[model samples]
Target chain A: MSSLVESTVQETSHAPAASVQSASLPRLGMAAPAFEAVTTHGKIRLSDFHGTWLVLFSHPADFTPVCTTEFLAFAAIAPELRKRNVELLGLSIDSTSSHIAWVRNIKEKFGIDIPFPIIADSNKEVATLYGMLMPGESKTETSRCVFVIDPVGIVRAMIYYPLTTGRNTDEILRLLDALQTTDKHKVATPANWKPGDKVIVPPPATMEDVEARLNAGYECTDWYFCKKSV
Target chain B: MACISSQGELSESARKMLAAMDASATPEDVASRTELPLFRVRAGLREMAEAGLVELNEEAYSPTQLGRSLLTP
Candidate 1:
């Protein structure tokens, strides 16, 4: 698998300059692209997280102010995510040694140990596969992007932030909670929905179903809109 | 709501503030006790308050039941 990734990277590296534009980003509901790469923790493959939810994120570079804060924030909520069986994997186009040094620096400066594997995509194989590199923004550095994959490896959600902004850790955790709740209960979450808040039931499929929903003992705003406790 | 139930869930600065704070402790008192910067203490207090672990009242911050519970084993 590593050899395959290397060959692909070599082929792309030698491609015509005109054909070297950024690849299209992966679409939701599609299988996440697989890869094997060196990480701060050692070698890892996408299949290693086959049966657990994964939060795969990319930062522009290590040792930057915004990225450092984002890493700390992510590390802060990691335990909460683990309670839901989600694992986090971070990536950037930096070397593994650099990643190790940066993680150590973060621990020293902030007194927080990052408890996740960080991929060192120096060759940009994984980044290219995930469309993490936005050439329009910076040809070398990856943009702030996140991909939430389910246990089955389906891309469930994606978020992108500009190079200048830091991400909200609360929003990321809330999104994971929302996705898990919807998957488990077959209900949709309303805007700004939190864990204990009422969830929106899917709209009925037929007139009879709608009529049944009206008397379903839930709080109904109308025939098609209803809220129920999970 | 998934309350932050343990110190591990908090950032390092927040945990420091949590350790230093007693009932009705002010941010300044926490900063002095924890030896953390004042801005960091204020930020940690805000995050703790958002997590339902602390409550702020008239320039004073106090840990809630959830906060105390987190301190316990």
Candidate 2:
């Protein structure tokens, strides 16, 4: 038991993008913009992933060193991601043939098959739709951007990295674990939290709730910062 | 209409609308899930209901077997 305080939460909407039809960067907690594009697996619509979580990521271009390493890393974790019901969709301002050539090259050389489809965004339609392009980095290439969309098509999280650095697949999986855990348990995860770790109990909204929280059996650092296992 | 081509595949908009549906959902839920405008979802649901692909129960819509055939199993 410890000192208690109360807080307030403002109701926010994550579903309004009725006027979003341009290439602007999408904000967090907003509905993901839609698009249709050609892929290594043929044409696909953003709607095609309605019931599944999607990792819509972009790299600089095919055949680039950093991007190649990323494909290998993603390939290594594709099976693990599928076990979590998350689909991987890659994008770049490159042609389908180039994607094919690069993927085939990776398979022939690195002996790893890229199980996911790579979007051939030569026209930049889908790339621009999700604002994957960073003009400051390169005019024609999409930067290393990742957008994690949930089952209902909401953009739950995004990460932007420079073209020079490859991303960490473990961190992506950890983020997915955190999001799904939060959804199921209705609690927030602490910094660097992983599976089987203590989750932060949502803070009390009133003084009475705060008082109840102290005896509520949580490991209370304070009422506002309690931890519990789901 | 444009919702169904001669090949019998659903139009992109119809597919999007249908993909957003589960056992039962309101047009508003479908709209937000697909990120399509509400008006389009309303119209699409009406059209799907007329085509026997979905059914209306008061304000909610549910996909029929025919509609389920078009989506991932």
Candidate 3:
């Protein structure tokens, strides 16, 4: 990864675009694909977000009604996300000027400033890297996708929603909370789990463990199921 | 250690430890919870103790009220 970063700095032609296009979408529990692009905030690299959990999401385009509503929703939760040590980065196949104008329009009309950076990926370099382009949806526009990246840069969670339907931002925040909770407690979240809810413990692996789990005082229906507050 | 939290003022490791910690967490317990190494957990506990974020009771450690405040918004 250091070599990739080094070559990216030393030469502009080292990472071939053809090779980039061939790469598959990043898998969960694997490192996220790296790229740098001009953003509304300024020139920035993916590495700039190292050491922090990042929500890297892409929309079909900016200034569209659905995308505008999503941006405002994301903006409303910016401070809460910051409290959890998470940073938001948005992307689309739009130019920097267009991104800036859209941001300004959002601010002027909605009276809400987007607190995060929006990557201006005009050349589709980044769009292809993350498999954001869905020809079934639109060749020129990116699909609405979200990648929840951990502090160590792994792609922990991914979600894709159709362009016509708006995304539920609360679920994004809930997913982040679940991921962080799992990391902090080594526990799994049950369906529709929320903060302060009892976390699911790992099931027993052997007979002795199973015997112990039953007598271990967790709220268990059987050796295979257990829940406890961390 | 860097004061990583603007509100808690605890270092990053300390905050991680406190967030994962219950009233009766051992160093190994917290190490697994935070996914931090035991050595770092021990060091972070010491930092927390020094800052009064946590207190040693019996063999387990618990957070002070001041520390609990940091865990909330």
Candidate 4:
């Protein structure tokens, strides 16, 4: 397959939140806000990620059991993320010392070092900016939230979970793949779309498209469900 | 409702809420406008402990002078 077709294939199989939006969120496909902060790796600018896809995430705290599990999952997949030319950045309201200590503990106990920078947001600036600090969960900590930004800094996707539940790593990677595929191929992934499945062709938004779709030799249960090659 | 007779600066979220606050807006309205969870909106209001930032009458949430400052442009 051509590189374009390969990227489309990658997108259909990737994460859950890619291209999805919650009803209350700011519209997707728009520029994400710029932020700079002190992370585990040191001070970094949002612009530093100018040429790569970014998975910017927030967790409530360090050392908590639920957060630890989620962190490890992401850490284990760090190589895969890097392979895809995507960078992962974590955030929390804890101080830098706390983040460092927690990472060390995870390494010693779990035998893994998180490869990405964990933002030590001492003053909750990043949390508040990302709308991660939900007071219902904890006033001083961020909730579990994820943002997927494209190479140009447009926020293509975001997902938030209640404090009681952890997020899925596979779902996120799947989303990143899906989004990049859509951008590259101008196609859409079907619900529960996985790799090798037929993609949803953008249905006719205008009258002419309806006829074009009909003539496209696609499987049409309905005009809206026209399935075509990716 | 907490009435704002004075003025002060607003936080980003609060400023967003103030623009949407009409006489009928409640905590839900503020939450929707700021894209904050309901409890977060409550906490943000409470965090605004500046004397008039949040006025609670019965169960409704309204801004005070300092709170309005955050919302009013």
Estimate every model's Cα lDDT from 0 to 1. Answer: 0.79, 0.79, 0.78, 0.71
TM-score of each: 0.69, 0.71, 0.70, 0.66
lDDT of 3 by residue, A95-169 (tens): 877888999999999999998878888888787878889899899999999999876666789999888988999
Best by DockQ: 2
- Give the alpha carbon lDDT tens digit for every residue of A83-155 in model 2: 7878899998888889999999999999999988788888777777777788888879998999998877778
Q: CA lDDT of A178 in candidate 1? A: 100
Q: Any residue pairs clashing in model 3, and if so which?
A: none
Off by over 4 Å in 3: A1-22, B1-73
What DockQ does each listed candidate score?
Answer: 0.01, 0.07, 0.02, 0.01
Weakest 10 consecutive residues of candidate 2 chain A by summed lDDT: A1-10
Predicted candidate 1 versus true structure: per-residue lDDT over A1-230, tens digit per residue: 12123332332332232123223446777666656777765456665565578899999999999999999999999999988988899999998879889999999998999988888898888888888888889989999999998876667899999899999999999999999999999999999999999999999999999989998899999988899999
DockQ of 4: 0.01
Error of 4 at A226 (Å): 0.8
RMSD of each: 16.7, 11.0, 14.0, 16.8
Point out where model 4 deviates above 4 Å: A1-27, B1-73
Better of 2 and 3 by DockQ: 2
Give the clash total for candidate 3.
0
Residue pairs of candidate 4 with colliding backbone atoms: A11-A177, A11-A178, A14-A174, A14-A175, A15-A171, A15-A173, A15-A174, A15-A175, A16-A171, B10-B70
* Candidate 3 per-residue lDDT over residues B17-55, each given as its tens digit: 899988779877897899764434654675577678889
- The candidate with the higher TM-score, 1 or 2, is 2
Model 2 interface RMSD, one decimal: 9.6
DockQ of 1: 0.01
